[model samples]
Target: MRRPAAFLNLIFSRRSIRRFRPGKIDAEVLKIILEAAQSAPYYYQAFCFILLEKPEIKREINESCGGDFIEKAGASIVVCLDLNRISGLLDRLGIVHVLKADTYPVESVLGVFESGLAVMNLIMAAEVMGYGTLILDCALYECERISEILKLPHGVIPLVIVCIGEKDENPPPRPRWPLESLFHVDGYRMLSDEESERFLENMDKAYSVEGYLKKYAGWAGSYREYLANRALLTREVRRAYESISAFLRRSGFRP
Candidate 1:
């Protein structure tokens, strides 16, 4: 078990810092943070992170993402995978090929999950090093235009972006589901209809305090809404996934 006090402190203390002080992060510090990201587990995939510091490139990216604030940070880190290498290995193993849209759907989801975990490591390390981080997936992957801006090869796609700098303010921790409702002694336990209703009702009430409309049912309603907000993205991501998968097959990675 972790020390609750220490863990709680970390949980409450960390916030997504958007405004960065104008200065360069020490080269050694950047190296350590990148190393922390590389330590994350990856399944049959290689991860590469790109650091963006050039003003011109940052400006172009900011324009592509439709958010000029992306250029404000000291630097932006983007995570990508070499899909061409992944596909070739899958071909040899006679496993599912990532080129097919059906086979690549779940694979893309898993790949994104891995990239997210890696970025999280960098964020945590930044906090410990007395820096702040705001991870935004859009800055690196707003649309197909971003790929052109990054000059990403057919098989390489930007998965996520993390902005690092010093925090200017403290952010309060939001409420979470109760611990009892969160854990089960053993096996899997799905939420009962009764519990589901109460769960969402309580959540709606909770967010009401913050002057938000509704929390929706459980978490899916809110998630679905968020997904819909970027509904047009489904096509771009699918195309990018196939592009990388084809590249991976050409490389050496298996399905």
Candidate 2:
């Protein structure tokens, strides 16, 4: 695949940024970036973007989700799925019962897909325009509280929060699995023990524990501890999953 040099550079140089300088993005630039996000391909689902530039709200979100970088960054954009809009349209068409009858695989799954597509578009656009962005999954853990904070409606579920601003730090790209490991020929193929071990060794060398700590020093914990901490990974993550599921059901997305 022969990609243009500009597109390849954008893809290759993009990185998840945590630290940011104190400066607001230009209004015109922000508008164009949001327009890029809106241009993403969605499968008939309406999405909403909430821009948060207020210092107090950013502080509240930082306290709630424990991602301090959010407050330090320039702004946060909350990407939400507008189920109410879809439901309203369906109701007007007199076919809202179709969703009520078969909701398992549609409402819950497709909304996420649409939001992810738009977010990626926004991220790439910001990166190309000399800005940094971070996708904050912590918002989902405190979904209800965040909903209240953002003043979101009952059917508008916050899918992901994106932090965008001027970059304060330049970091190297994170290590990824080798092409052979990620790209299986035609179908899925599980890696053997040796292959898996080799991959782990390569990653360990590419990104040592010291490197991880230095990069995310604000987290204030070892990488191993971060991974082993059940409070954040298991408990909070499970709660986030349940919250989204319950939100969908309560919003009449159940069969």
Best lDDT goes to which candidate?
Answer: 2
Q: Give candidate 1's total backbone clashes.
A: 16
lDDT of 1 by residue, 20-117 (tens): 77777788999999888877787655456878877888888777655444677766877775564565667788876554443345565566677777
CA RMSD for every model? 6.4, 3.1
CA lDDT for candidate 2: 0.77
**How high is the lDDT of residue 64 in model 2?**
86
Candidate 1 TM-score over all chains jointly: 0.68
lDDT of each: 0.66, 0.77
Write the residue-wise lDDT of candidate 2 on 42-76 in tens digits: 87656788888788998888898785777777778
